[model samples]
Target: MKIAIIGCGNMGLAFARAFLKFDLVKKEDFLLVEKGEDRMEKLSSFQPGVITGVIGPQIGTYDLIILSVKPQDFPSVQEALRAVITPNQVVLSIMAGVTIANIQTVLDHKAVIRAMPNTPAMLGMGITAYTASPEVDMTQLRKVENLINATGRSVFLEEEEQLNAVTALSGSGPAYFFYVVKAMIEAGKKMGFEESVAALLVKQTMLGSFHLINTADKSLDELIKAVASKGGTTEAALKQFEAGNLDETLIGGILAAQMRSKELSKG
Candidate 1:
């Protein structure tokens, strides 16, 4: 299938690389539209059969198109694509906040899909949340899912509105994980370790904890209880966390993120 990527930014390049890595689409079937000369040079070095030129060439005559441009540039993108994309072509938008209905309005009622993917997609470990309208059939939806699944795992949302929650969770989730790692590292240092030692400990601890969570059949609270024996150091830390209402704080943070996502989409 012919595929075109409009932005060639990090996410776009990531998807392109995953596509090439899996041999899902032939090199000749892909076209990249990038304005940055240096970045374009980088893409050329990858030896993918990517035509770096006007969006018009790439937008027209493509079976599938990935819209990865910045949200602010979408007006010009819509204007550029109005006469080019046929009803048969599908538009998969990876922009954070844009909705499928808004995209279809721009493309004159063409098939449109919205997807939210995070930074880990560059490493093929991201989870993408996508939704499609009635314009897409089950077969077409699976085709899109297959392409997205190349980058990482994917989930379909029945209600398009839940994309906001997806944005708050997986979309911004990587940074949250990193933030936790940072806090762990800092706490380690405060407890009298060298910076490098603390970093390594935190990293390995996180990895091990992740493996334990995956392998263990116990619920998270039960696992925590297992570690926090009565009146032990772990129990003391848990008490502190409970005193500070960490759960409430986390819920507030996620809600804030969801609100910001809604604001971006409205913009």
Candidate 2:
């Protein structure tokens, strides 16, 4: 399919790289519209697609157009996009908190899909949740889903509102994972391990645990019980965590993020 990407930033480029890597779209069939001189120059090194500095009538020719611009930058590009966007063409947006209704209204076009993909998409290991307007047909939706899956995996939500929860859970999930890793590393340092050594230990443990979670035919509770043996070191740490209400705190923080996402969507 012919695809056009409006922004070439990290997430945008991540999609571009994944599409190319999976042979989903040929370099010739891809078009990149980026305004920054340095970014445009940098894009040349990768040569992912036909690069241009401005949105033009030619954009209407593509089968699918991806809007990956910042939420604040939508107004700057909307007018230009509206002028050339065709009704039959599908527009997929990855901008955080930008609703499908808003995109369809602003662009004066239908068949819009909005998706939330995290930073891990840059490494082709992300999980994305997406939703589409009623105007988007089954074929178009599936095609978009296939494209999104190139980054890792994707789930389609029936209601756009669910995306706010997804934003809090998986969208901001990597940072939470990093936060825990950092705390563990700090605790190791306090226990007399060097910073690098601590990082190595914690990272490897996390990695192995992740693989176990995926491969082992065990529930999360079962896995936890296996590690936190009765009155063991892991159990002691888990007890401290429970005393601190860490699980509740984490849930509260994610809920706060979801609330903020809703507020942004309203604007």
Candidate 3:
């Protein structure tokens, strides 16, 4: 199928690379649009066979259009393609806070799908949560799933409202993990290890813990209990975290993100 991707920025490039890697779409069948000359040059050098151009009349010919532009840039993009987008074409958007209704209103098209994808997509290890407009058919939805799954995994939501929560959780979740790892590395350094060594230790520990959680049959709580024995160091740290209300604070922060996402959708 012919697919066109607008905005060849980091996330856009990630999707392109993932799609190409999985053979979901052929390079020759894909169109990469970027306004910046330098970026267009870079994309062309990376995939010479792929069609590259600035946004123009040619976008109307594609069966699918993937909107990867920034949320703030949507208005201009909408205006540019509003006259060309047909109801038969499916529009898949990855811009955070740009709701399905917003796209339909702005672009005057109903077959839209809004998705929340994380930075892990860059490595083809991300999870995406998506919801589609009622006008989208099952075949189009399945195609979107296949394209998104090439990045890693994808889930469909019946209600579009859940996308705000997904945006808060997985969409911004990578930064949360990195923040904790930063603290761990700092703690290790304070305990007398060199910076590089502390980083290595913390990174490996985090990776190993993630692997264990994924492969182990036990629930998360069970694994936590296994690690934190009564009166042990892990228990001591857990107690400190509980006393400081760390979990509550983290949840509050995520909710705040969700609220911000909702507010942005209004714009």
lDDT of model 3, residue 193: 100
| Model 2 lDDT, full chain set | 0.94
Please report how far candidate 2 places residue 165 from its true position, in Å. Answer: 0.8
lDDT of 1 at 181: 90
**Model 1, range 1-267, lDDT digits (tens) per residue?**
889998888888999999989998998888888877888898999877776757674467888888898888788677778877788888899887788878887779568889999888888888999999888888888988998988889999998889999999899898989998999889999999999999999899888989989999999998899898998999898889899998889889989999988888887
Clash number for each model: 0, 0, 0
Worst 10 residues of 1 by lDDT: 50-59
Q: What is the alpha-carbon lDDT for the whole of candidate 1?
A: 0.86
Please tell me which predicted candidate would have the highest lDDT against the true structure: 2
After aligning candidate 1 to the native by TM-score, how far in Å is the CA of 104 from where it should be? 1.0
lDDT of 3 by residue, 199-239 (tens): 99999999999998999999999999989889899999998
lDDT of 3 at 227: 93
Query: lDDT of all predictions, in order shown?
Result: 0.86, 0.94, 0.89
Total residue pair clashes for candidate 1: 0
- The candidate 2 region of ten consecutive residues with least summed lDDT is 226-235
Local accuracy of candidate 2 as per-residue lDDT tens digits, 155-251: 9899999999999999999999999999999999999999999999999999999999999999999999988879789989999999999999999
**Cα lDDT for residue 154, model 2?**
93
Where does model 2 exceed 4 Å of error? none
Query: Could you tell me the lDDT of residue 259 within candidate 1?
Result: 92
Q: Candidate 3, after superposition: displacement of residue 119 in Å?
A: 1.5
